[model samples]
Target: MFFRQHRYSNLIIPISYFLDLLIINAFASLLPIQFQTPVLFHAYISFGWIVISLKNEFYKIYRYTKVAYILRLIFTQFVFFFLILYAFIGFFKQPMISRLALAQYFVFVFIAVFTIKFLNYISLMRYREKIKGNIRNVVVIGENKKTNQLISVFKDRTDFGFNFMKQFSAKSLDFQKEECFKYIIENKIDEIYCSISELQNDELTQFINFADNNLKTLKFIPDNKKIFSKKLKFEYYDYIPVLSLRDIPLHNPINAFLKRAFDIIFSLIIILGLLTWLTPIIAILIALESKGPVFFRQNRNGIDNREFYCYKFRSMAPNNDADQAQATKNDMRVTRLGKVLRRTSIDELPQFYNVFFGTMSVVGPRPHMVKHTNEYSDKVDKYMVRHFVKPGITGLAQVRGYRGEIESDTDILNRIKFDIFYIENWSMFLDVKIIFQTILNAFKGEAKAY
Candidate 1:
């Protein structure tokens, strides 16, 4: 069966890792510095190399990865590795180990590793082009400018190793889904490329299910309209851009774990260090001003559109419209203390608990009230895509002055645009940057903070 085919390609990463490690140790042995414990030295450097490579994604070169990206990885990896080498010598007080010899060792290792990497990359391209090995037989499922561009890539870039078998016009009356399926099965098509703009919702789902069942790779050729946005991940087939709709960085298990860990650790600090005392003080102030619960909880749309009761300091007098209406600037429902709370963004501090409980993140798209979520989702395009990640206490949209009342449709639309950007291009540094900016915004006071 096509699904049962042995994929030796899976072994490439591991094999590459092993070869790099081998090169590192072999060069270490040739160094003039006589290590007191040779095995210890080798193990330390090898472990350091692996850790650094994994952190930098040094070996994540793909067929579509640009040569410039590979060079950047190599530069980043070697710079860090050089620091690791010097740190080892300094920490161990290796007086006998000559710095000059170590530098030479570093140069030799870089030369050897660089030569091997490029050689392998070029060899694979040559092998695919000349021998037609490691080829994927693919079919295009639409006829359009974008699809034609992609088809041209498959035909021209033999080094990419895609064999274009046929083109099926999804819009054509003569095009039958069953016939396409039969052809795919009989010809052992390895991948299916569909024009997302050309297919109906049902047609897209059917192809997705068919590809999933057959273990065939599925990709989309998106319309050029959304290509300018960073919301979707784009890869170049030669010069043609092909997008993956759901390929956000946080979708990776490692990245998701890292973001979640940051959320938990950061929330713990706030909840224990600040909120423990601040919550009671705020509660007393709210009680003094109005009659209501210290913590206001309302159901909000969370990750995957799941409903969760989001927590915030009680910033309004008990009212019927708390869940249905957003707080407007100079609104009467806001208590005297609520005005102060909202202005300083202290009302949002209680959401750290939500973060600790894992219902939200420290930095992500902000969750909206259920009423607004339902209303906007119907009216706004790609608004629901923000639900792909956990809601944040303060998001890119909030920091960028899109928070508070939605005065106009453009306000919500701009918020959605920022939210989508955050979801797609998330990183640890980006989260930290947003947190710092949020702090600065609170101190300065935003016009929309009312």
Candidate 2:
């Protein structure tokens, strides 16, 4: 009944994931050179993939994620798959197959899965954009700036697949809950978003009863101006109730260890492999073009709103305003060599040191200058949520073409949306995806990369 009532809203990412593996194995079997492996080996491999992928949250796709983000996710899944596969093998006393044949299997299966998923992603995105596909009828049950903002975003971005059905004021609905219920039932609304402040006591009771009876989705938006975040956690203190607004996954011990280990290992690879030679070349170029420190350090907001000196190659000449001023396109402060560095994002390489030192992550919400943080926190509600995780050199917002200068209020607003999405749906797979997407965007050049 629930599945029938919420048709098209339940997008199971795990099904697509399983299909990718199934298709890969199916295609590989037809190849001219096939590895002879025991049936048990394949079954164990399948089980291993399922368990690890779930642990990594490989199947948690947000409603508004784009094609690029989807592909990045698949790329990450495959990247980590080998580690899981071999680790499973390493645990056994006797290996089942030749290393050479297994290598070929890995290569062929990865290529097949990656190609098919990419095509499917492109098709899905196009279908959603032009065909009114995956549309969800949603109604808001509150009157507030945030609710209006939600309506505006959904109305403007059809690609998100939210259909703004109607809104019911709590004050008015308090007297006549059935009126809202009638419209909901008649229209088959899929979800209801209510302001906790507006519908307390009996009004809240009716709202919950109606939704529960109909099996409709219910989401509560906090009414308080200062204290709402992605997740609302409940704790019991000797039977006393405790409510926490934070839902940051990185705070988990295992999750934190996973993320931090990846950050350290990945940063070390870059620092050793590329930075060893590339650093001197870039440093010399920067010095030749202008006179200042090779590295630029400025105070930015880090995890938990702590101040840290974020390091990047000095892409701009010495300026007293560097602390407060943002770099805009075609700015005179940027040198010729600086332009190349910024375009390729090599300017951010020094921050790998920060990642190695535990001050940053491989992927996260990009930290903003103290001035920008203070300025925007007032303008944007829930803006402080991004600071719950350690800042990153490249983030979901940056890869989604929201990086560089915040020229308008809309720009920052959209950036915050992507950041919040990353926080809410975080995983090691996501960080890997964002890292890959960052590299791809750098090569293709982003809109605000200047």
Candidate 3:
């Protein structure tokens, strides 16, 4: 199974350890300090590293090679090792540890660890070339152009290790009962890749059930390219494999809990501490200008296109529903206080509470009004993918000056480009950078902001 090919490869651990040691040594050699107890310090560091790696699940094999995942692992583990070292050596004021050794340890370890993996990948490629290993005997259960492409790909890139065993046409198969099972048994199949659209619902279900019962691997390659499903990890029940798409990036229990904790702390500081003071000032100004409500509420599309009422300071006339025209520069709709609120982004202060409630994120693709969503989604290609994660108070597009009126289709399309790019290349560092840039942009006063 492609998923389990690298399972239980303790090789990854020792490689990591060697890499860490090399990095530490390199840093140590550059520093002035010398080790009083080199062996004991080395053992303590090595053991601590191993325990940290296990706790972080750095050894668990991934389904595919992703730079993001690997970089994340390296960063988290690097922090853990350094923090532990600092506490044990720096705070305790231990002189036994060499500063040079510590520095070398970090650099060498990281380099060695990733290098070994890269070499291992190269070695595997060579091995596959020699023995024809890693070859996937693919049984594509479709006869569409996509299936034809798959066959062509296999023929073209034998290096990719695909060996097409047979092609199953939906029209020819008698899928009323055990049809897939009978076919598989007859063909001596290794794996099944099915396009859900190629078969009727009942037939697809029957085949899936048969595959589950037989413990065979089932890979779904949907024909709808617009949907943009990703390679997700599967959960098994006995022999049954269940596939999932909405594996929330933050919903990983640890990350979810941590993000929530940060949100609560952050929201508390903003709402009770900061907004408690700013809201009244804004309200008085807003009330004096417009003679209406202090806050505006409207439906915005959230994760998975779910509707949620987003809150903001009433930055326009009280009756401006989402159907009203988008606020434009020097538009008559802008109230005196509304101009300031929108300019400095004081209108978005209410969303801290939304973030606190876990309905919105501090940084993500900025949510659009439900009407705008319906209007622009059709106009912009792959527009719906922006809803893959929770909408944000600000986003990459807004930071890049794509806010305010969408006068042109190109504007909406470019905004969607940044949104999709952010989703595909998301990271904690990216989020932090976006937040920082949003703050800087807020003070600079975005030209597009009405």
Which candidate wins on lDDT?
Answer: 1
CA error at residue 94 for candidate 2, angstroms? 11
Q: Between prediction 2 and prediction 3, which has the larger lDDT?
A: 2
Q: What is the lDDT of residue 75 in candidate 3?
A: 78
Q: Count clashing pairs, candidate 3.
A: 19
Q: Candidate 1: misplaced stretches above 4 Å?
A: 1-51, 55-218, 221-246
- Per-model TM against the reference: 0.59, 0.52, 0.54
Colliding pairs, model 2: none
Best to worst by TM-score, what's the order?
A: 1, 3, 2
Per residue, candidate 2 scores C-alpha lDDT tens digits across 369-399 of 9998898776776687787678899888888
lDDT of 1 by residue, 225-273 (tens): 3423435566778677676645667755446667877888989999889
CA-lDDT, candidates in order: 0.83, 0.74, 0.69
Q: Worst lDDT window (10 residues) for model 3?
A: 1-10
How many Å off is the CA of 366 in candidate 1? 1.2
Number of the candidate with higher lDDT, 1 or 3: 1
